[model samples]
Target: MIRTIVGLIIVLALSVVVISSVPDYSLPSGLQGVGQDYTERGVNDTGSVNLVTAVVVAYRGLDTLGEVVVLFSASTAVVLVLTLVPMGANPTPSSSIVAFTSGVLPGSIVLFGIYIITHGHLSPGGGFPGGAVVASAFLLVMLGSNKIPGKSKLLASIESLAGVTFGLLGFWGMMMFGQFLNNMVLPAGSPGKLFSAGIIPLISLVIGAKVASELSGVFSSYRKAGGDE
Candidate 1:
């Protein structure tokens, strides 16, 4: 244990040193103008009021794909942990006040998460933040309802489906426009409208569901373990 801790500290120190030493790089002169170009293209070509969404889903979709993979890995880790332990081995009682708060707060949080996800194409919050919010709501649910069982298989299925759907969507884009994950085929409606961006909202929904289910599954497993004890 001492060696492990020491090794971890050394690794962290090395990472910090290396990361700090990385040279600062600026955008190319022509690329420096890309923000304005992206904004204009977002408004006209993608009809997305939020330039960030346009950049993430349309311009830099490969990065978004990587982010989804990270979320998937998190879900997989949770599933693996839960599977290693038997259910109903430990039970932990939660305070009534906490239960009440969890129940009441999660509803508002769910609504807010949806709002953030849907308006991602028009504002600051996008899939990542929105998905995190949704996961928080699920965590609340797991804490509040002790009797409720987590649907691990279902959650895993949803995560896998979302990942596959994203991949297929990217592949379709490649087939259509010779660029993977391109959103050009989407009908660019009026900027600021709910239906403006074609796949951004869809992707957000998938992300939200994936995050919520995975986190809920993890929380439920932990809660179940506590209940057993």
Candidate 2:
């Protein structure tokens, strides 16, 4: 009861503080400072037409790295939980329609995911979404097929390698250019082209690989842990 009271007090206090602070926080009318700079020089500076990608993979690449680390930690936690959880569930395959679609769609889904990852610098998709899409393919298989998929060891190895590759590329940039994950390591080709944007695509590839492997492994583990097979 004391803890509950304390929690309520804390929540109320926070709410009061936020309400008091609301007047002091004004919404920006438009882009200013860094935003302005990124808007103006982002394309020429990073050779990436997609300003967001330029910022994520070049200007503020460390932030993206931190996000990856967070994801890795989460995946690690899930794996630890996997060990604690019993894997005694046997999943029966789904109906014929689902089985057929699983066989049919996975290939296309995987291909589309790769396309999204590779073309991230030029388009609306990136590593996270693309990887999730790929992982969904694995999920489809798990839901529809009879055979157990996602070799945990292989997935883990791929995840580790992808993570290592991401760091190594950053280090490579640091060694030669003194900036980590510098996209200027290679020629930032003409914008809006497939070969443009230098290291951005490479970074996306690794990020996609890491995310896909982690999610696929988690899905497989869940399926084996008594979820829908």
Candidate 3:
């Protein structure tokens, strides 16, 4: 009861702060808040045809990186929690189902995910969604078979390396231009092309790999814990 009262007091304080921080009480019409500022400046600033990608992976990169870190932390927390419980023996494998799902579905999902991650500068999708799609392939693998041969370590390693690479690159930019995760670290080539948008695409790729690996590792851990039916 004391804990609940304290929690309510804290919540009330936070709500009051939020309410006081709002500049305008009335909601503006569409595009009034954001305006054309982002769209106007995005093309020249990041050189990505996809304004959303430029904003996410270039302009507001640090926030995205923080989000990835949160995801990674959540996955780690899950692993730690699951470690308290003893895992069961591996389930029985189905040869035909495993063979077909492993052969066909994973390949297609991975290919499409890669396409989305790579072409992010030119298209609608980027690292987060694409990585989720790629991780789905791993889910399919887990659901289809009992023993997944020798990829969990690799995935974990990739996830770690990608996260480190992202941080290092951000520091590299800070060294060069006094800005964390500066988009100007690399040359921004022609827009709407594969190699355009400076470090945006590179960051997207790293985020994609990290997200995919982290999610795959989590799903694999759950399956190992006998959460699978």
Candidate 4:
């Protein structure tokens, strides 16, 4: 109760200070912010029409790569959990639901996911969301059929390859331009084209494949733990 009261008091004090300073607030002028600079030169620098994609995949490529590592770690943890604790048998689904999920939804989801990842430089969606969608295709298969389709070993191999490819590309860029993940190694063609962004698409594809394979492995582990055939 004392801690709650103190928290409320602090909130009230901060609110009062903000209210007092509201009238004095004025927008700064003269120098354009980095955001404006990114907008102005994003296409020219990264050859990606989507400024957000350029910022994420080019300007902050290292950070994006780190995020992929974090995701891979999380998926590994899930696999470890499955190894430790066996899951229960899954409840059977309706025939119609199974048919739809197995026959129709998986293909559509896979296609859309690939499209999203490949066209990320020109569109709003990127590798992360696209990867999740691709994983959902595996999930649909799991739910529709009583058995997991792909072998976990294959998925693990692909995941490892993708991670290695990403790291190798970064090193290659560093070797060529003296800067890690530098886009200067590859020619950045005209913006708004499919092949405009040099390494962005390649990186996105790797990330997508890595993520999809990792998540699929996680799902397969869970399925095996559940005693599903």
Task: Compose the digit string of candidate 3's lDDT tens values, residues 1-229.
Answer: 9999999999999999999999678865556435477787788888999998888888889999899989999999998887687876776765786757686788899899999999999999999989999999878877777673333579878999999999998998999999999989898888888998999888989999999999888887777677546
Looking at model 1, residue 194 earns an lDDT score of 89
Which candidate ranks first by TM-score, i.e. highest?
Answer: 2
TM-score, every prediction:
0.77, 0.85, 0.82, 0.82
Give the higher-TM-score candidate: 1 or 3: 3
Q: Residue-pair clashes per candidate, as listed? A: 11, 0, 0, 0
State the lDDT at 95 in candidate 4. 77
RMSD of each: 4.6, 3.8, 5.9, 4.4
Model 2 has an lDDT value of: 0.86
lDDT scores for all predictions?
0.76, 0.86, 0.86, 0.84
**Least lDDT summed over 10 consecutive residues: which range in candidate 2?**
145-154
Clashing pairs in 4: none
Poorest lDDT segment (10 consecutive residues) of candidate 3? 27-36
Once fitted onto the true fold, the runs of candidate 2 whose alpha carbons sit more than 4 angstroms away are 1-27
